[model samples]
Target: MGKLREVEILLNQTQKVRFERAMERLQSLSSTTNNSVIVADSIPFNHDEAFLKGHGTSLVDGELLTTVCGVVNHVDKLVYVRTLRARYKPEVGDIVLLRYSFVAQRQSRWRVDLNSTQDGLLKLSSMNMPDAVQKRNTSVDELNMRNILAEDDVVCAQVGESQRDGSLLARSNKYGKLHKGQLLKVDPYLVRRSNLHFHFIESLGIDLILVRNGFIWVGEHTQSNDPMVVDDEIISSKTRQSILRIGNAIRVLSTLGFTLTLAVIMETFDLSNMENVQIHDMLGSEFHVWSQRGKLKEEHVHSKKNVKALI
Candidate 1:
């Protein structure tokens, strides 16, 4: 952590404040040190004591250290990690937004980059037809798959059952072909997994999809429809500003390494409005520091309350 501070010194005003915010976030996540797994932190096991090392652990100078941060398990003789939030360990029903590339003209499925070890598979059969019928995919569908979603298409879909080749699953067009939105990427760890990933904020006319893979989409709200028909509706000035403001909110939160949640994001947005900070100036050093430092105080107070409850 000292290295972080040293690096912060090298950054300019805005960059320094951003680092401070990220540092604050790291501290906030570390509130529960007993369970919070930090990489390279020593395990409880004794160096002399004989015990089998497991996943996320490495032996350095005869001491076991965790490589990944997650739940620790000691069963019988072997030990391992659990509930790992370090990476996008794909699960069934996870909402994901991925940019896909069609490998070849004859390929029936496009390999999607889901920010995982192995690329996700989106088959032609999983896509919704123009008429919305669930039928067996044909050669014609295979031939026209690129038309529905050509190379470099950003798709918002759900994870289905895993395939035989150990690739993450794909689903229908319930959340398909995201268009006219700003896609922001962050560490998957910062994106907390939630049962409801799609959030449409009526007040701001914004559609917020928090994909488990840390790809956030903030755009003008639109109903899910057939992917065949392109909706090229022009966004009004007011709505465009709303979209950009929400996108900036996301950027600030991500820059601070804060967990991106709907409530917190809205809170930040509301706070900015209350402070009368301009949309473009939210990224200024003053606002970033104030935002994160304020958030840190809240987390501290919340943690203290939890501790008092335990007493």
Candidate 2:
């Protein structure tokens, strides 16, 4: 069966009970707009008038409400649904990736960028210390922001209580510290905010970060002289662009059955139309192509002077 057909079958199977309940509820209510599904039997405006915040409006066949100028259209199927609730929650015990941005010794509070618009505070008292270490007596200001969290060193921290306003607070060394990891980001609109945990890249064996801010990142943990080499300089423009185009296209087609695979021609070096192009050349050319397509009128083609080639 087709993918969409399979999806429809799955949706129907999962939502059968809920669908029946919604239809029954709709039949009992008096709605101004027709929100019912259009089945084979009767066309009674059907729709579940309940408005769920992030979730979509529940509608079945045969419900009625408002139609522009009295024209009526039956509900065939629901195209989308909203997440029921959120999965990720900030608490005192949880370890989180943190970025420190400000430090004020006099105030005895430090600021952290916890993937939120406003920075969170970290009180000095939260620092965990052994009794022996505390007795050594070191200078207080010695714990400078730069020393603790140089500009962008990612750290792990724990959530703390706010002083007055509702701004969040956190502390590292209180729980533990984060060293290195990858980050992955997904469109927030495409995911249910409450289901943040589901977006994690655990299956990929990489740390998944769902910053409260929309950005997410995923990085593989590498430790070796020859850790997974990513050639930064040698790729050609045309090849680079082709890779990105193919990647994006593959991503868009993921929900469908489209898959990219190396053909037999690629295994054997039959470099006919496929000239030896560098990664840089492919990337630059692809970028240029996109840039040219974006402009209203044709302009000069982008220069590929510094771009390198990749085998």
Best by TM-score: 1
RMSD, model 1, all Cα superposed? 6.9
lDDT of 2: 0.34
Mind giving the per-residue lDDT tens digits that candidate 1 earns over 27-76? Answer: 65557544445466666775566788778888888767777656567887
Task: List per-prediction Cα lDDT, in the order shown.
Answer: 0.68, 0.34
TM-score of 1: 0.75
Please identify model 1 stretches exceeding 4 Å from their true place: 1-40, 44-58, 65-85, 104-106, 163-173, 294-311
Worst 10 residues of 2 by lDDT: 260-269
- Residue 269 shift from truth in candidate 1, angstroms: 1.9
